[model samples]
Target: MPMPATALQEQLITAVRQNDAAAITRLLAEGADANAPDGRGFTPLVLAAYDDHLEATRALLAGGADPNRPVGGGNTVLMGVAFKGHTGMAQLLLDHGAELNARNGEGSTALMFAVLFGRHEFLDLLLAAGADATLRDNKGQSARDLARQKGNDHALTVLPE
Candidate 1:
């Protein structure tokens, strides 16, 4: 008999957390729903990309994971990748249709997160991918403003005056 769908999904979540791409792929083939939120309300793609599991992220995307799915505080996988300075993961998320300006509950965009966390390296990639630099958080802080506030000199240098 086939493995129960719920069991496969649970195992798929575990594989993503473990960064086991092969297991993730196999579980998806066995009818795991990559978009299904686990008990924690996080989808497989969100968990994989947020944790910087590149291969696991790829497998989940291949299995039809929605790159735009919101994780906590309405933050998407791209936001997490941005904060962590993972260019590869950010690029993959972008290629998979992650929204550039998607905001979290605080109305902060991925660019803002990058600047806030001093992940200045991600600035160019995010801009090149079409992130709106003018977007402000709920506090009305633009990427540049956040950079200044956070004392991110590197980010300030990259951002325009």
Candidate 2:
């Protein structure tokens, strides 16, 4: 079972959900745990990334949140960034050492999400960062296979040759 969240962590999560960068900064300064997860396993960083709150995401990262922290369903922060098509947030996570090929519970990598969603902007970034295009999901579908299934020809071109 997940540990109960501290009041400060809850407040920080609220700031993240609201996309309140200023509030996030203040809470971080007050020594709130940037890596603390909400009731559903969403860390402040993951929440900010999922919401496309770039500034709030940055604040959380600066506050020492783990960029590789797993959120809902064992998806990493990079997964949220990729799923949301937030290329800039993806870059931020990459710069902070988020695993390029980290797999979620379904064994889906960030590159797979980029391909599945046709997030071409993130495709190049994930590819260049060494996201293994050949990594297969639980369904035995590689990123290339997923792109092909989705009829995302452009994404297929970005995958490893």
User: Please, what is the TM-score per model?
Assistant: 0.92, 0.88
Q: Which structure among the candidates has the greatest lDDT?
A: 1
Clashing pairs for model 1 are none
For residue 123, what is the lDDT in candidate 1? 84
Model 1: residue 86 alpha-carbon error in angstroms: 1.2
Q: Give per-candidate clash totals.
A: 0, 0
lDDT of 2 by residue, 47-112 (tens): 888888888888888789898777777899888878889998888888888999899999999999
Across residues 1-161, which tens digit of lDDT does each residue of candidate 1 receive? 99999899889989999999999999999899999998888898878887899999999998899888887799888888887889889988888888999999999998998888877668888987778888878888899988888888888887766
